[model samples]
Target: MTDNKQPASNVEDPAMPEDVTKESSQQHIAKDNAKTLKIRKVTNIILLVVCGLFVFHLIADRFIPITDLGRVRGFVVPITPQVSGEVIEISVIPNTLVQEGDVLAKINPIDYEIALQTAQQNVTQAGQNMGALSANVTASEAKVTSAKASLKNAQVQSKRIFAMADKGVMSQADADNARAELSSAEAGVASAQADLAKSKERLGSEGENNTNVKSALLALEQAKINLERTHIIAPTSGVAANFRLKEGVYAVAGQPIMTFISSEDVWIEASYRENSLGNMKAGDDVEFALDFAPGKVFKGKVAFIDYGIDWGQNEQSGKLAQASGQTGWLRQSQRFPVTITFDKEIAKGFKRVGGQADVIVYTDDSSIVNVFGKLWIRLISWLSYVR
Candidate 1:
């Protein structure tokens, strides 16, 4: 074809058009690159959001700490007998429920009864003695008055006799006799006055107000009190625990015979990390779970925070030692006790004192975090049933 036309290389190829193929390949590559870039940007934004949420959760948990370190606390009253006597009867058994003023036990009352009778008799005797003294005072006063009248008459007779003797109308012997009578009557009056004074002193301010009567009254009251104490009554409404009294065992004064776990009130004693107390305050909301009632969350409020703890206490030596220095690579956080009061009634028969519990505190701020915190406590409560 070169003799008259161009070579075969110069002929156009329809199957492999250069411009169309290049344009199509370039469009496919551009579309793939754009899709990849869009995917990468979405992945980065998702990762940033996830990381931010995790950091917020961590910070919230740190600020509002929760712990499983808690115990049920209430008043544990010791059943100490005020008076010493033999136990004759026991009305309640160990771990039995009792009410305030219910007789827990009875002591032998014969001795106390005898004491009361003796005290009464002494009081009566004192009253009688005081009455007699008052009567004696009245009698002595009357005698003093009569003796003074006699003394006055005797003195008048002596003066008249002396005047007659000086006028030669009466003998000196008569005047001397009259003077002796007057002196005797004066001595009698003085003696009667002394007796009256003695009687008045014995009578005191009045018969009932005498010192002896007052002392006897006090003794009588004490005896009555002792008699009443023979029946050991419950101090409050609660359950009696650790009771070991027998029918004839001697109950000593001021010695505890049993423990009364008072049901009048109950509370939670929770220990939290010291670092977590920066915002912890009374009246803050709290949630708790009891070992006795697992899977159940209880509501409460912070009642108080203990001012101190026995971290350095040495019970045997009766002194507190300095807090031990940080010894290891890891430092332990100090814990402080916080008292929480129940907002609602606990399950009946849930032994509160000394029972284990898990507690979490919710501060006043951050409602969103508090919602999550509440969810966590409920989860813990459910978990408590299993573990």
Candidate 2:
């Protein structure tokens, strides 16, 4: 026992014990560090995804669509009368639907029919006159032939008498008479040739723009116009608008007895914010919300964009300057108008008549960004739940 107690004074195996303890402590620390590093990596990845989504959402204005008035549109119509006549019957009323060539009114055909008959009579008379003229030309030619024969006989007689006079056997007066007759015959032949030329000119084909032919054609045209006027037809297929016409109403030339609105050419004119213009372009996908049907949404593409803003009567900001010589300033928003037309059957479902509509324009390209935004939203919602 005394000897064992004496070992306190002696040096123990310090290196061996110290090495074992240090090794055990280091192993524990390394295990803890590996776990901590794993947790930190997972947290960093989650944060990076969240940040990406946040950025995408902030810039989604380029991709996410906004609504505007740039999509509404319509068409214009000009009222025209096909013929001039008294209105006898009217078929379509105001706002009535009509197809192409549909009758709108009727005109009295009696006057036109009479005019046609008169024209026909005139044509026949002209033909008869031409025949008579031809016979006259033929007679003039015969006269020329007779004149030549007489002139030849007179010349022969003149030569014979001149020979006799030279020989002192005939008088000079007879020879002079024969010479005068021959001269007269030559003049007559010339007149006949002139007459023949005139006849040929009359028989020539009339050019399309010939004044006389045009006049005759105009007569035929008038007859045709009268016939067409007997039935007043719509120029195009559309709905009758502002029509005050009825049976027995007198219609004048260049007067609008009725108006027509196109049924199939309806469109939306939408006004978009200037700030929302960056992402919007022609042919962009769009959604429409009509003012009439608040719940219904229509689909269309951006058909057009205004080149500039138009601020009517009231001067508003960002209105494009009016063109030179434009009239009075009316109070209206000076915004660029865009045209949008619906192609789907859904637009038909809504009762739209010059209806007001708003549009959402889309302007972005990255699907990954959209996905990131979605994930971020989900994460935010989950975090809120956790909280």
Candidate 3:
């Protein structure tokens, strides 16, 4: 029943070592293999950990963001020249507070005063000529009336002489003389009337004095303007600075001697990243801190956000480039400016033009899902899952 079969459990070890030296080498090899397995396990674990950290950083950068749009600074100005002359008086030094209409300096107004005098003389002369013309006109009227009376008297005499000659009471010679006298009187009256018309016309449309009067009036107005320009007054309430000018320093026409920055029209401009602005609005809370004046905080609401990158991309955007120079990839995260105005408290202390400040804006929509909250939640989840 068990023919030609070997017993399974009773078999002897076929590859048994015959010497002690051989058995020792085999045991050493077995030990080395175990150590290699441990070292490989440690290396693989380290690589996995480093890769995971890199992936986490890349994802986190997408959720949280920051930017700086640099500081903005400028000054105010009214660039019209009030007076045209050498500067005689400089009352305001650089960096002074000026109220509205305060005199900053004065020009040599002598020329303007002389101009006014000349204008006055012209008006006076024109007025005197007009007076003389009026007197002549009145005289001409009186002469005309007297001549008309004489003419009437002559006509009556001529009619009486003609009647007497027809009745043989006067000689023909006497009648002819009477007629000549009447003609002479009539001509005198007509001449006087013509003189009156000439005088009236001389005072009005045909007169030389009318042109003089108009010219004098224009000169007077110009003189007044020039005289008023003698006083250089501030156009706005502001802090004045940058005075490279002083008394007797000739400030040229339209040249800026100094600058004034208006305190009334002060506002802050803050720039935020384009990617981070998705949830921002005009009514979000904005907190600001000034670098110029530390420990001061200003509160404001978001005034507005810009439409797009105001400075457009290079001309290579939608065209084929022959050869492009170093127009690198635009930052996937771009920033646009946002304006924030100070609350009334800002006016109380540091309300000034060109004051610089750092700003932070937060939206109500970012309550639990925002960067801060989301990071805290993620930390907790990662800790739990890893454990």
Candidate 4:
């Protein structure tokens, strides 16, 4: 009875605690498996989404090409003076609009004017000299004709006197005198002819065709042209930019004094990756945004695609081709310029040459790609504000 009563604490089963510990470990393992499975599923989903986006971008890039490397371009003309002189007047203000043929500035025309006047006088004098030469030629011809007639008479008289002397019908002295007269007439004729030929040589061609007259006329024309060039007329309808010319400033011939940007020839130049230009062609629809006018998208069309680039172009130097090495795994893509012309007039005062821009071309009518391009360009336009 004593032993059974004392063993109450030891009566419990020893395997029960071990079983409980084993069950707890099993529960932890099950929980860990569940968590790992969940994490795997999440990672797979993320990777799938990323791959899908990459594929979509590739397809969009092929059909709907886009580029942030764009610029507004126009006829950027250098306002150079054709005549060198002191600037006497500036008719147009800096950055002001001017019409074609409008005078932008004036060079001192005094020297050119005096040159023109002198040229005119030279032309007049040449004409007068030509008239005198013609008269001299005519007088020489008349003298030659009179001498030839006298020579004919003298030849007949000499022949008659010689026949009479041979027949003994006239004195030998008379015959000798006749022969002397004939010789004198022949000499006169020869001198007159020489004078005529010399006069003709001096006259050259007649009237305006004369060499001296033509030279004078050319000088006069050049003088007139030089005088006209003193007035610097606008080459095209555009704005006179950076007009720093002032009165009394010396302007050198062919040296640019200012800049002229043509308004009518405004366009956009976009540089796209070479792979992106495969399907693009002229007349393709285009959308562009300029940094100067943020949040505004303008419509345009593809004017042309440049056929060549300067990169990797070697001049005609006789040397081995220099090939560049690529150290990185991925090679850089070459870019080409595509010209875009506006479909309509751009907003006034917004067109500026060399302005940064973004552009996109719609190569096909694929609604999905086009819609995405439209949205993407608009988004870029809005982002331009922050940029």
What does candidate 4 score in Cα RMSD to the true structure?
A: 5.9
For model 1, name the residue pairs that clash.
Answer: none
The most accurate candidate by TM-score is: 4
The best candidate by lDDT is 4
In the order shown, the candidates' Cα RMSDs to the true structure are: 7.2, 14.1, 11.6, 5.9
* Model 2 TM-score relative to the real fold: 0.66
**Models ranked on lDDT:** 4, 1, 3, 2
| Cα lDDT of model 2 by residue, 80-191, tens digit | 6655667888788777668888987787778788889887676656556556666776776787787778778877877788888889887788778777877887787787
Error of 4 at 303 (Å): 3.3
Candidate 4 C-alpha lDDT tens digits along 1-387 = 766575557787889999999999999999999999999999999999999989988988888999999988899899898889999999998787788999999999999999999999999999999999999999999999999999999999999999999999999999999999999999999999999999999999998899999999999999999999999998988899976677999999989999999987888899999999888999999888889988999988999999998886575678777777756757888899999999536656777888988899999975588998899999999998899
| Model 4: lDDT of residue 169 | 99
Clashes of 3: 0
lDDT against the true structure, per candidate, is 0.86, 0.66, 0.70, 0.91
**Which residue pairs clash in candidate 4?**
none
lDDT of 1 by residue, 186-297 (tens): 9999999999999998888775568999999999999999999999999988888977678989999999998899977878889887878877889888888787887788
Off by over 4 Å in 1: 1-54, 310-324, 327-330, 344-348
Candidates 1 and 4, the one with greater TM-score: 4
In model 3, how large is the Cα lDDT of residue 153?
Answer: 97
